[model samples]
Target: MFNYLKELSFTRGAWLLLTTSCVALEATALYFQHGMGLNPCVMCIYERLALLAILVAGMIGFLAPRFILTRWIALLLGSYGAVKGLTLAIKHTDYQLNPAPWNQCSPFVEFPETLPLNVWFPSIFEASGNCGKIVWQFWGLSMPQWLIAIFAVYTVLFACLVLSQFKRSSGMRERNLFS
Candidate 1:
């Protein structure tokens, strides 16, 4: 059992599985928010953006199966997510800081409001809610906290993948000489 767990942790398949799990978690959270009574706060939306980025990158990486590219993509995204998560957590530590003016969160993209063919949608750029409100939590850590952790892990995994690519390439060259 321990050996199996260790093997799973190091494989590309395991990373793919982890990506899928994260996607499912985000989906479930959204489902609960829209289907149930919970509404997303400002920070929640930011976190969603980070998660979406990761999900999209993961999907693309899965399609190509390039270790180096996948690792670089994960590293870039994980760093971005870490920054966002930290900002949100800091916001939550205080009060009376209006989340409106600081609102960097918005929908992925909404339909254009303009009726004419030439006119584009009037983007009502507005601020959103704060980071303090609890949408859901376990052991006192919010969803964003969990997301941060996941991203960090992904970053490391991708780095390993990058290393694995180099090792595999070198091994292939050696095998060619032997043959």
Candidate 2:
């Protein structure tokens, strides 16, 4: 199983699959925002950015999946995205479930000064909804709750890939020592 995972990390198809999944997720976010009139909050915008990071990482890995350096870079970026997304989802869920005047999310989206996403792409990055409002739910789970699950999956997959990479490297070292 470890050997299979190690080989999978070097395949372009695997990276493509990761990128495609993120694309589908982004499309769904757009559909929810425009088609369904579900305005996004600050936390939602941040979570979207995290997903975008993973998507970019997938693209990088797809470009040079066999290159060890490229794979490492992609792994770092994907891990960052997964962890950040998961954290944001949990906080957002908390905001919705335990609303308080002092514990409310900021009204404005605060992107980095160099990358003012809200200014560059208002339609996609702007935050117009209240974070504590439970405007949508499915089967007793709110939007943030659903996002927590999604990010958790991404995080776990990245963790497995990282471990596989380490296993492959150690195996290579052992083979070289014998050779």
Candidate 3:
């Protein structure tokens, strides 16, 4: 069962689909912020940054799905984003669980000032709310909780994708050497 899933996940079309989904996820987040009037906190903004990284990874994976190096790059980027996201999600989850004094927490993170995205699209990338406000929930799981789960799964999948691609390249190399 796991093997089947691993094989399916490593396919070229699957890689493209995986990366496209990251973009869609980010779009949905923007919708929640803009369309739903839900403000995101600093942790949420950081999560969006991680998601943006994943989105870039997916776009690259989509453009060159069959290339081994592309797969490795995608896996690295995806894993990086997922791991970073997981940490932020965990922090958000803690903040939600244990209400902290706003004075102790920074409302918005300070960027390097060179990052124009936060300035140009403040509505999307900027943090507008304090952490610990559970404005959204589904099946009793808050947004950050869901993010943790999603990022954890993505990390595992990225690892598997890397392993699968490495095996494929090595196998091809062996076949070429003998032939």
Which has the greatest lDDT?
A: 2
For 40-78, candidate 3 gives per-residue lDDT tens digits of 898888898998788788776666554556656776898
Clashing pairs in 2: none
Q: Clashes in model 1: which pairs?
A: none
Candidate 1 vs 3: which has more lDDT? 3
65: Cα error in model 1, Å: 1.5
lDDT of 3 at 140: 100
Q: Candidate 1 on 1-179: residue-level lDDT in tens? A: 33343333335686577568668967776685657646655455555656666676556545434344554565456445545555554554332233454544433333245633113411111213435455567798766666557656655555454444444242122212123
How far off is residue 169 in model 3, in Å?
A: 5.7
Of 1 and 2, the candidate ahead on TM-score is 2
lDDT-based ranking: 2, 3, 1
Q: Global lDDT of each model?
A: 0.51, 0.91, 0.76
